[model samples]
Target: MRGWIIYKQNEMLLRQEAYEIHRLLEVAKEENIELQVFSPDQFDLTVTRDDEKSILIDGKRQELPDFVMPRMGAGTTYFTLAVIRHLERLGVYCVNSSHSIETVKDKLFAQQILAEKNLPTPDTMLVKFPVNVALVEKQIGFPVVVKTLSGSQGSGVFLSKSPGEFDDLMQLIEATSPKANIILQQFVKASHGRDLRVFTIGGRAIACMERNSNGENFKANVSLGGVGKLYPITPEIE
Candidate 1:
């Protein structure tokens, strides 16, 4: 058995996630499945006149793998998504389906879909110029969580504790990036400084990690100075 993990092999492999990916590779090897790392920018997809689709890895055509693991980051999201789409055309299965990824990649779009499905989520509003402060206060209230549409890993996220703060934030954002896509989400006041990160696979909860700010900051993400505590999965968490 063979598989591929699509990622930015050059840069990301040097970060903390490198250990995670290496562990995956080691586990795969133990299971007699060869899992290779493949960079998103290192491949080219070609469609032939004979209606055959081929992928070139490091300038050489390669056979399609049994499965794919997508680790596409913010920088090459669209290009990697396109590559994943092409891979699906060649009958390769991805851990996360391409269409679902696309939907969630766009923050507002995903929220809209969730809202339509009646899933519980924070009330959110997409930012608009000449902003409606009244509507924002009515829907989101004070202490707003402002986030860029495509941000990840605690980047491009901000908080406005008051209406004045929100107004100042908009001014700064407009001055820096006039057309930046943003959204205002209601603050979950009770969840402040602590949150749970649950890992799910194949529609089943596998592990749960609690992140605590330790009174250092409002964000409870371990990557941002928070402490992590792993817990056994339970029915409530599931």
Candidate 2:
């Protein structure tokens, strides 16, 4: 059967999702499953006679694949999900269905879902316009963590110890990306400079690791120069 993997080409250089895609493709090739890369830039959507169509690369005319894997990044979110939904409408399977993926990709929304499911998570608050920095400081207290609503690899995460510091940082961020919205949260002091990196596939933990940050860094993301040690998954992780 034929399948396509869709992902942002630019982010493939450093993202772990890219590596996961490569591994899946390698396995597919070994198993004799037809696999192909479907980049967003290589296709255009059109609707004719109440039927949707995609114009693919190399000027080839083709129907949708048997399945699609969306490894898209934040930048290509809307288009990637649109394509995935289109494929689903055409009877194609998607690893994470568009709606489910969308829910997880949204940080605040995901936190809410987890909270509803009684899963433990850091206390978080989504903030928009008319934000009162003083009120936020009073509630979450000093040394709070701020993050953009949509970011990966700790790109938009920041630690602010004071209202003035938070304002300054927000000013800088606004000057750069004016459209950005953010979330404020109580920093997990116990988890300071460390966290568990658990990889789950098909609802099972496949790989696990413990990551510790370098000196003075709070984020333990490997992309941010943190060191990681492979660990066996305990019952808690599972």
Candidate 3:
């Protein structure tokens, strides 16, 4: 079996050990699978007569892999998505379909969809220009979780413990990125400083782990110096 792991340009080149790509390649090697890493820029999609499609990677035509895993995180660009869509048209399976990625890329849209399906989700409100801090307090309450529309490793996430803090953060965002898309969620106090990270494949949960901030931060992302331990899958996590 063969697979391709797509990531950002510099990330793959640097071969960061902290990133999942390294671990994935190691596991693939143990399993006797040919797993190659490629940045989106390395791909060139060509469409010819009869609607035939082919790909050139690193200036050379190559056979498509059986599957492709895109690990571009929040930096997923339209061109990369187009490349993945092209791969799909060429009959290669994408671990996470492009449609799903597009849908979830907008945090508010993903939450709305989940809420629409009767799934339990935190009460969320989209942030707009001239944010109404009072309204957020009324709807979501204090100590809310503010997150940019797209982010990973807890980079764009914040814990606003008070209206003043929330307003201050909004002001900073306005001064820097006035057009940034963001959301405010009612903070889950029960999960403060810790959360579960679950990996799923083929519509089923395969592995689960707990991440902790050691009470140092509200975000428990491994990229943020948090610690992780194996966790048993429970009904709630499932």
Top-scoring candidate (TM-score): 3
Q: Counting only residues 3 or more apart in sequence or on different chains, how many pairs clash (N, Cα, C under 3 Å) in candidate 3? A: 0
Each candidate structure's count of clashing pairs: 0, 0, 0
Total backbone collisions, model 1: 0
List per-prediction Cα lDDT, in the order shown: 0.82, 0.78, 0.85
On a 0 to 100 scale, what is the lDDT of residue 204 in model 2? 89
All candidates in order of TM-score, best leading: 3, 1, 2
**What is the full ranking by lDDT, best candidate first?**
3, 1, 2
Q: TM-score: which is higher, 1 or 2?
A: 1
lDDT of 1: 0.82
In candidate 3, what residue range of length 10 has the lowest lDDT sum?
Answer: 9-18
List of clashing residue pairs for candidate 3 = none
- Tens-place lDDT digits, model 1, residues 1-238: 8889887784335456576677887899899998888888888867655555457987997888999988765544777888898888788898787887787778899999979988678999999986777889998898899999986667787778999878988988888888999999999888898888888888788999988989957788667788889877788777
**1-238: candidate 3 lDDT, tens digit per residue:** 9888888753347546645787888899999999988899998877655444347998987878899998886688999999889898888899788888888788899999989989788999988889988888899998899999998778888888889988988999999999998899999988888988889888799899999989768888888888999999988778
